[model samples]
Target chain A: MKTRAVILYGLLFLSVFLVLPWIGPESIDPGKIIQFLSGNNTPDGSIFWLQRLPRVILGLLAGGALAVVGAAFQVLFRNPLVEPFTLGVSGGAALGAFIAISIPKLLLTWGPFSTLQVLAVLGASLSLTLIYRLAHRQGGVSIYTLLLAGVTISIMCGGGILLLTYLSSPNALVVFQRWMMGGIDVVGFHELSALFPILLPGIGILFLHANDLNHIALGEEMALGHGVDVKIVQRDVFIGGGLATAAVVSLVGPIGFVGLIVPHAVRRLSGYDQRLVLIGSFFLGGASLAVCDALARTVLAPTELPVGIITALIGGPLFIYLLISRIGK
Target chain B: MNKPIIELRDIYYCYPDSEWELSLSGLAIMPGEVVGIIGPNGSGKSTLLRIAAGVLSPIKGDVYLAGSDLKQMDRRTIARYMGYLPQELISVYDYTVEDIVRMGRYPYIKGFGAFKEPDQRAVIRSLERTDLTEFKHRRLSSLSGGEKKRVFLASVLAQEPDILLLDEPTSALDIHRQVYFFRLLRELASDGLGIGVVTHDLNMASLFSDRLILLLEGKCFRSGTPGEVLDSSVLKKVYGDGLLLNKHPESHRPAVLPRIGPEKSS
Candidate 1:
């Protein structure tokens, strides 16, 4: 069953990337795109390979990572409504990036040791840790407290980012604004390489504990009786989920509903096996983001909208529909 | 037939602001014994079970499993020999019946890894035992209330513990399912597993249990066979109202039928 799902998803992914670029306009001609992919390229083909391909790949990776993280958080916290944005990791990452861009000199002085991605990851980790610690009451953390804490911290972090944006130089402000508005153009192999180490380990750990996570969803006492180290599982899930969310934010800005929508869609298809959910979430998320990115690039031709705008535009109505349907059920 | 599998020594637990600590000075549960713990709400029946299951560490005293102190043993090691089902049923994911049942093999599996062949067989066997084989692929949310209870019971059964502890396992079930489940528990106890069930149904407890422990105000009000513990005076002491106690016609087990309000009684 798993093998079949993987194969089907792989074909879907291939067709999306391979077919969509060909159907576009002269600037992104299908033949040139193919030639560029095959390593025999014109200037236009080179542009597509270097610029468009990286953006697409990054969107796929970031989307998959974010969706898995959101799914993990929902399970770990035992709340169906939890998502990357709700957990404050995105806001924390934006603050980190805002700080990094505003103080480029301060960052540069660290001797090639500074990057927006690293800062974003650090900020996300710290904020998430703080939220976890604060939300914990007695021996356990309540989902309600965690959600409230996440929202509170996110608001605070957003305020800080706004302050930083206002105080920054116009050039820095322009860069930060574009990044915050959710540009896919900045992603490249270098950023992807930076993202791989943290994202891969975090995701691997989550998948490893998928069974325990399933037990946890039953409740803490039952999970412990089943021999789960509840505290360790909780810590690992928070850190891993936070890191994965941060990785995506660092790359593509906070591309909204992929994490929220993909997991919900996958859950409807995959039942409740966390292993299948995790894997299926990766594919669904990647496909969703790829479709969104394709639309973002092509919908207006010469003038492309921010990928975040596209996701929100598409995601809002879908989210509302899901909300109403869930309530009805 | 065998040494006691669980022994509680001077166990005392107090909720944060409670005036008095719930105390069980000494309690011993032998292998294959079906013990029913009965009390009103807030009488500490569930609390005692939680202490026995190691979900809550008693403020004072020790719990011994197989004569070894539970505090000394790791939680996972203790879990291997004990299964606990809490009062509430909250399944976070929409896991299938089989997947939920397989969770019982969690302790045996290493480091949250994939299930082994033995785990798979145990899960299948448990599903069969619970009569949930046909519903194995169905999502939990799709199951009826009775079905969900059975699935949860199946999950605990899959744990294959030598000792089973349940808190109000049948409180949410209909009368028919409750009777069916109590019969099932009796069968399991006959198979040499020590079972401790906390419940409010004195009749069912008397019918199925080999011994009964009546808790009132954080202490054992009475402990004996159902015939001795289910008397009118004890019922009056535990619950305010005096009730008539008699043997059921078919089962010849003690059953209590409390009087209703004054108008109905008159």
Candidate 2:
């Protein structure tokens, strides 16, 4: 089973990196792709390079980051259902997006992220910090406390989002609604470039804690007995998840289930060694989101559906299945 | 003079949610012996092991590991000298037997580290000791309750500590496995490792342990050789009535048998 998971996952992952970029709104000629690669510029090269390529890469990174972060949170909290979204990070990012849209667009870009993207990250970081504080003040952050605090913070942010949406004029409403229904529409390499620096380190830190995570998976008390610094690791991992999820949510608009579903699928497919699960979550998540985006782009042809909806449309059934199975069990 | 592997002095511990308080002036485990703790439920037997393992801190006490204070030493340092096995396993992810055992080497491993040759070798050694070398590749979920217990025991053995603290190590095992496990502990103890086991099986405790500490209401009610500690007078005080006693035919060690009748006790 472990061997099959690796092989099937590798094949699926490779298919996206090799094949999915070929299908988009405007189909690029394979001949043109070869010519562009060979340094002979084709007429469709800019459309392919500046638009399609960055978007695919962004989908890969965003999906992979969310899933890895999800796996980390699951292990840290000792609950399989925990994802960045459940922890109120997406709520924070959603609030940031709402705030960014409430005011007129600011002409600012940090590295590759827009001023709006930066605000979403800052908002996510702030929200997680608040959640962390609430959980930590009681001493040793138990899983129940974390989930409770997360839901409370998320509800609070939801209230804020409701107020912002209520005050919006019809003109702002459509744009706000579109942004809220996230899509991977990187206009150029700039946004992708900005995300790489933040995403890479965040991903690296989470992956590096696989052993500690393995101990933590048994239980927090067990982890401490195995010589883990539970308090420090918990704090650092929460920040790491916040940083990565914030970066992805800033640009991709809280693309749900990548974190929630991908890590889960990886663990079920492979065994529960964090060393395997984290890396598998990265590749599988990247490929899965890329496929979702591809379906979003080609399904409507000229009109595009938000990639987030496409993911939800597919992943929602998995969630219900999990619920039914849990109830049945 | 040979230093005791672990020593506790002037220890006071309390649970925040409960009214229980435990205060002990001193308890120590020397190298090369097995010490058994027998207590009623909530008598702080498990709590003592947790404090000694550095999983919990006493309100006021000094814990010495090889002459260094436990509070001053980091968790990794404490783990280096001592290994602890809890009463039961947590709800774990799908992990192979080998994967669970290898986690015992976490203290020796560094940041994002690969399992080195020594780590793998230690895992193999532990698997061999626990009679689980053949089952190393099996999934933990598929194992029976007792086999899973051995897998966790293997994980602790892989830690290769100077001392072992086990809570109820024989609860789920068959009689044969329980005897086997205790024999293994005796062998390990004779090899210069201090072992402290907290269990409710008075018969096995008397048979295997070099010394016994009987606890009640968070205090050590009796501490001596098993022969002295397992006396009928002490058993009656700790366990109340309906108690009968026998002896192991081969070892001639005391075996406790409890009789239950409707009118025996309230």
Candidate 3:
């Protein structure tokens, strides 16, 4: 069954890769799309390779990261509603980027510190660490406390960012606005390099504990009876899950809906085995984001809608459907 | 034949910093004893069982397993010898019956853990013993309350522990399932496993238990065989008046019958 899910994911990826270049704004001809892949250079092929390829790859990576983080957070909190953004990690990153943009004097004096992406990563990491510490009692983090803390911190950070935006110079405000509306076009090799090491290990840690996470859903007392160290599992899950969310936010701002929607969809298709759910989430997440990114690029033609907007448009209805179905059940 | 498996010495426990305390000055449970602990609510029945199972550390005194202090043993190591089935059986995941039962092997399997052939066999045997083999693949959420209780019992049985500590094992079962479950526990005890159960049903405990420990006001009021502890005087002291204790005509065991209050006497 797991093999079948993987194969299906692979086929989906291949199909999307094949369809994206031809259906985009410039509409690289089918022949050129094929030729570009075969390493043949035509003028039409260069446009496909240069512009669409990076954006598609960025979408796939960001979507997969968000889905995996969402699944991890759901298991960590033992709540189906938990997602990457719910825990203040995304808000912290947004605030960090907002700060970096609003203060040019600070940026000039510390050139390396001026990168919005770096500031976002640092801000998310710090906020998540604080949340973990504050919510933990006797080596365990309660879902209720974690949720409350996350909401409080997120509101505070979000409000701070708004204040900073109001005080910023007009040019800085424009940059901040663009950054807030997350997109896939800005990912460079350097950002990917910095993110790859952290994201890869973080996802690996989650996969390794897939079985343990499944046991945790049985409630903490049962998990402990099964010899699982509940406190240790809780701490490690938060840190690893937080890092994955922070890494993705560092690259594409905060892509919504992929995390919130993908894992729930995968669970409906696959049984509630964390091993299957975790892997399935990655594939479906990547596909969902790729499809959304393609629509974002094509719907407005050259205008390129924000990826966040496309996801929200699709994800909001899906979320409502889930809520209604769950209540019915 | 073997050293007493578990011993408690001068143990004292209280909810943190509270003046009220639950104490067991000295207690020892030997192998193959079916001990039933009965008490009113808040009489420390659950607290004593938790301490014995090593789930809660006593405020003062020592717990020993095989001559070593419980505190000195790793949590997993102690868990290997003790199987605990808490009162609530709420599960987070919708695991299949087999998957839930297989968790019992967790303490036995080593690092890079995979359920081995022995573990599989144990899970199968547990399911069979609990009469749940037919429902092995069913999700826990779909099981009836009695069936769910058996599944949880099967999980503990899969652990293959020397000592089984259960808190209210039959509290919520229908009368038929309660009798069946107590019979199962007696059978397990006969197979040489020590069993300690906390229950409110004194009649059921009297029928099944080899020994009964009656507790009141946070102390053991009487400890003896069921015949010695289930008398009218003990019942009147532990519980209030207006309860009658009589010998069942067929089984010849003690039975409890509720009577009207003295004020209702016309």
Candidate 4:
């Protein structure tokens, strides 16, 4: 089981991780690929650095962070269907992105970050803070109450986005619509630097709590007996998961299914140990999303389909298969 | 003699947003003793065990582990000395027995730490103690009701705690395993660990326990050797009328007889 798991994860990683950045719409020659990568003379130099590699890394970070947080959410809530968006962070970020694109007044850009991205993080933190305040009771955070609060906030955000979508001008509406469709399309090093600060540490915190997450899935009372500080774990994960989700969603509009499916896929491939599940989700989530994003670029060629579209297309069917196979077990 | 390993004093708990009031005035567990907590359903046996194990906080009163107040200590510190087994377990997850047993070592390992030799040895010893050494790699979903219980028991044992608080450890066990479980507790106690077992099986409690504490209506009704506590008249009050009890022929401990007819009305 040990070696088999490693090999399976390795194959998945290599197949997608190796082939994705190179096989875009403008295929870089192997000769040119080396020159551009090694910082030498190449006509396609800016294209490789500015477009392809950043997009690939964006997909990797976005997918890895979402799935990692999604895995953490599943363990924290003890529910299989709970995704990264279960806490309303995506809703908040989506509304922020929508407002930035649609509203004429608030559309401002900062160095290495846009007004939208900052607002998205702010919105996500706001929702998370609200959830934490509402869920805390009797010296404990009730997960059910947190979930209900998240759902309520998500519903409110959804309505707000719909209202803004209706009020925007036709031209701005089109841009907003495309942005809502979601893609891992980054143009330069600024977006990468912006994402790195938030996502890396958030994912690292989740990785540290991997074992504790396993204990939590047993039950809060049971986890406490196992020496987990249930309240602190709850708070840390909410903040960590919220920050990661916000960071990615603000950069590339919310990519669905990676967060929900990767954890289930990893669990099905491996076992229910969160230590393995967390690590596996990161690898498989990044790989799966990278592969899908690759298809989004190549399948449509010059048109450039959104990566989110491909993710749902591939992930929806894959999840169905996983669900059936899991049921069979 | 010396301070008990686990001591509960004046603990009061009423379920949050519920009317159920449960309390424990005082309880103690010393090393090298197996204390059985026996009572009818709804007598708060589970709650008492949870309070003592530091899983549930009491509104009023203090729980001191060894000599220190548990409130001041972190869960990790309390967990090093105490392990709690829940009454009902969900075994649908695809975790290996070894994976679960390995979790018992969590409190000892710092964050981002991997298992070392001592940790692995503790897991192996725990598996052996619960007689699940052969089932280490087996999935929990593949095990039987009784075998799954052993897997959980092995996990708690892997913690290597000085005190164990077990809620209904025997409820899901077969007769042989139930006897085996009691014997295991006896063996562990002899090695100088303390155990508190909550059980409905009066007869099994009588057979293995050094002493028995009978709980009724959220209070300690009686606490004494099995011969003193497991009497027919005492059980009649707790059970409310359907009581037929006698001494075991082999062990000479009290045994409850099956209700032969429609249970005597309360």
Candidate 5:
């Protein structure tokens, strides 16, 4: 069953990978796409390669990162309701983006990062550091303390975002509101190249601990008995999942529900093994977000809805159906 | 005549900011013997087992595994030789019985791809020994309390440890299954595993155990052969007068029975 689920999710991801690049407000012929791949310049080819492909790739990376982090956090915290943003990463990133929008003077680019993206990364780092310090103890970070600290910091960041919203000009408020809704509107691969360094290591650290996470979900005592170094696993899962989440949120402006629902959807379809769950979540989450992004682009034809809105709109109802169907089964 | 496989000497433990403390002068589990830790509520049986398993470090003194200091060894090293079954098992995911049991090989696994043939054989043997082969694919949530306990038992068995520390291992099992489980422990002990069990079933402990450590109020009340430890005078000091003693029909080991009547006015 789990193997079949893996294959099914892989097919979904591959189909999205192949199909979504051809799906946009402007229809591009397959021959033209192949022409673009072979180095011919045409209007359709340019749109397919430069506009649609980057967005789809960004969606896959960001969605996979968020979902994997969410799965890791749920196991680490031993709470099914946990998401990637539960630990204040999104709150901090949103606040940072809000700062960039409200204060025009701060909107300067540095290296590969725009000032908005840089500030969002900084904001996420600040919260991650603060939460770690608050939760750290003599032996290690206490999971309960870490959870409480993350929540407190998240709420504080939310208040800061509200204050920034209240103080902003109407135009800035509108931009900030749109940023808060989240999107993947990259024109090229420059941003993705910068993201690979952070996202790869963060997600790699999580993947290495998949078996440990499996033992951990049973309970700390059981994990300990199974020869898992509970303290080290706790610390690594926190920092790794935090970094992955911060990287994705900093770029995408806090896309919701992909992280929250994909792991659960995977666990329901696949078995509860972390190895399979993590892999299934990555593929299924990437596919789900890619499909959503495609819909966001072509749903109204030319005036794109934020992919974040589409994800929440589509993901929430889809997850409910999955749950209801399982119950009915 | 064999040196003790696990020894706890002059150990002391207490939870932080709590008045209750557990202090022990000495305890040991010899090779090829089943040592039962029988105690009243709050008598620290679980704590002792945790200390022996190296899950809980002693506040003071030493725990020795095959004469090496326990504090210096990491959990993985200890787990290679010692298997511990916690009293409570709760899972957030609907893991299959086989999945849970397979984790017992974690200590032996290195740079994972898949379990080797030896690990697979151990899992199969554990499931078969526990009569759970048919239920290998069943979700843990679908099992009864006794069945869940057996699944954990199978997991611990899959570890293939030299020493086993179990807390209330048969608490949820039926009468027949409990006896069968104790018989299995005896077989394991006779095959040279050092077994320590904390159980409330004094009669079963008396019948099955080679030695018994009776505890009262976080202290060892008695430690000896079942006939020596389960004497009415030795037990009355801890249990008061709400008990009766009988002899096992076959083994002639001392057995405990609860006195059934109206409660006496204090």
Candidate 6:
């Protein structure tokens, strides 16, 4: 089962990376892709090179980041239901986007980031800092406290978002709603390059601690006894996962279920080893999101649905099926 | 005397916002010996065991591991020569028996790599020693209580440490399995590993341990040979004459029996 799932996910990941960018609303000529690679300035070449490819790459990176972080956090927190969004990253980002939309005077751009993205990241960082401070104790941060603090902050952010929506004009409300329904619509490599700095190290830290996370799943004291510096692992995973979630949520506006469901689906396919779990979640997650993005782009042709909606439409039923089947087993 | 594999001297410990405090003047476990820590509920048996294992640090005094200050050593370095089994093993993920045991090699793993040949052999040997070879592929959630405990024992065994510290390892096992477990510890001790166990069963402690330390209210009341420590006079003071000490029928080791009150006809 493990071998088959690995192959299946590997194939899916590679095929999605190659295939999804070719299937957008306006199909690019196969010859144009080669022409784009050779630096031609044709209209078709620009569409394929500058537009579709970047969106596809963003799907891969953002999806991979969320799932990998989700897997790491689940082990670190010792809870199966935890995901990237559980730590208030999504709530904070949404609130930030809402603020940007409600007040157009704040709609300024900096280098690669729009005002909304910048504020979203700032909002996520704020929530992360608050949760960290709340959970910190004399010796180390308490996992129980961290979970509770995150949930409380998420609720507070939700409330803030609600108030902003109530006060905003209908024009701002439409834009906020669109952002809330997450989409990955990058036109070039600028946003992708901007994400790399925060995203790389964040994901890298989680991947590096895969073994420590495995020992942690046994229990905290057990992990400590087995030579894992549980305190360091906890701190790194929390901050690392938080930063990565913030970056991805800022860019894509908090796509749903890819973080929550992909790792679980990977665990079902593979076993509980975090080494396998993290890697499998990355590939399978990347593939799942890229496929969803393709559906979002073409399902209504000119009228695109949010990729987040497509993910929920597909992922919700898939998650339910997994749950029922697990019970049946 | 042989140098103690692990020793704790003048240790003081307490949890924050709690009145309970433990102050142990001195304790040591020498190689090829089993030291049973027998104490009533909340008498600091588990805490002492954890201190010896280097999992818990005392606020005052020194812990020596193989003649070195334990506080100065990193966890991986400490774990290389010592194995600890926590009392309650709550596995968050449903890992297989082999998966759990393989984790015992965590201290030895050099980098971000797969378990090597030696680690695999150690895991297999541990599973075989604990009689868990057939159950290696089974998930922990599917196992019986006794089976689960043995699985963790196997994990600790896979570490191949010179000293082992266990907290209430047999509290959940049946009588027959408890005896089997103790005998296994005895065999491990005979092979030159020092073993420290915290247990509630006095009779089993008497039979298995070379030395017994009886604790009362955060202090060591007695520490000596099991026959010397399990005296009726010594027990009466702590247990209030509610317990009787007698001889094991075959081994002649001191065994404890509870004294019954006056019978009522109903």
lDDT of each: 0.81, 0.83, 0.81, 0.83, 0.86, 0.88
Give the Å error, residue A320, model 3: 2.1
What is candidate 3's CA lDDT for residue B53? 73
- Cα deviation at B165, candidate 2, in Å, is 0.5
* Of 1 and 5, the candidate ranking higher by TM-score: 5
Error of 4 at B68 (Å): 1.7
Better of 1 and 5 by DockQ: 1
lDDT tens readout by residue for model 2, A1-329 = 25566677778777787787778778788788778778978867766776777888888888888889999989888777788788888888888877887767652656656678877887788888888877874336666777898899889999998898899767667877887788897546876777876778888888767668888888777677677888778877888888898888888887888888888887766768787788889889999898899899899888878999989999889877876875896
lDDT of 4 at A230: 83
Q: Interface RMSD for each candidate model?
A: 1.7, 1.6, 2.2, 1.8, 1.5, 1.2
Each model's chain A TM-score: 0.88, 0.91, 0.90, 0.93, 0.94, 0.95
Q: How accurate locally is residue A194 in candidate 1, as Cα lDDT from 0 to 100?
A: 69
Q: Stretches of candidate 3 above 4 Å error?
A: A10-23, A27-51, A106-114, A327-329, B17-20, B65-69, B72-76, B108-114, B248-253, B262-266
Put down candidate 6 lDDT per residue, A163-265, tens digits, no spaces. Answer: 9988999999998888888889854798778788788899998988988888999888888778888888889999899889888888888898998899998
Residue B23 local lDDT, model 3: 80
A285 in model 4: Cα distance from truth in Å?
A: 1.4
The candidate 5 chain B region of ten consecutive residues with least summed lDDT is B257-266
Give the alpha carbon lDDT tens digit for every residue of A1-329 in model 5.
25787788788888888888988777778788789878888788888888888889888888988899989999898887789988988888778878887899999876667888878888888998999999997556788888888899999999998888788899998888778788887537777666776788899999889888888988887778878888888888888888888788777778889988999988877778898889888998888888888898889887888989999998889878877887898
Candidate that beats the other on DockQ, 2 or 3, i.e. the better one: 2
Writing each residue's lDDT as its tens digit, candidate 4 over B1-266 gives: 75699999998988868887877779899998899999988888998998888777899999999789999999888888988888877643678889888878878898854889999999999998888988888888788888887787787887888998889988867899898888988999999999999999988888888889899878899999999997877977888567688888998888787667676766
Weakest ten-residue segment in model 6 chain A by summed lDDT? A1-10
Candidate 1 colliding pairs: none
Docking class of 3: acceptable
Looking at model 2 chain A, report the run of 10 residues with the lowest lDDT sum: A105-114
Go through the candidates in order and give the clash count of each.
0, 0, 3, 0, 0, 0
lDDT top scorer: 6
Q: Against the true structure, whose DockQ is highest? A: 6
The model with the greatest TM-score is 6
Model 4 residue runs over 4 Å out of place are: A1-18, A29-42, B259-264
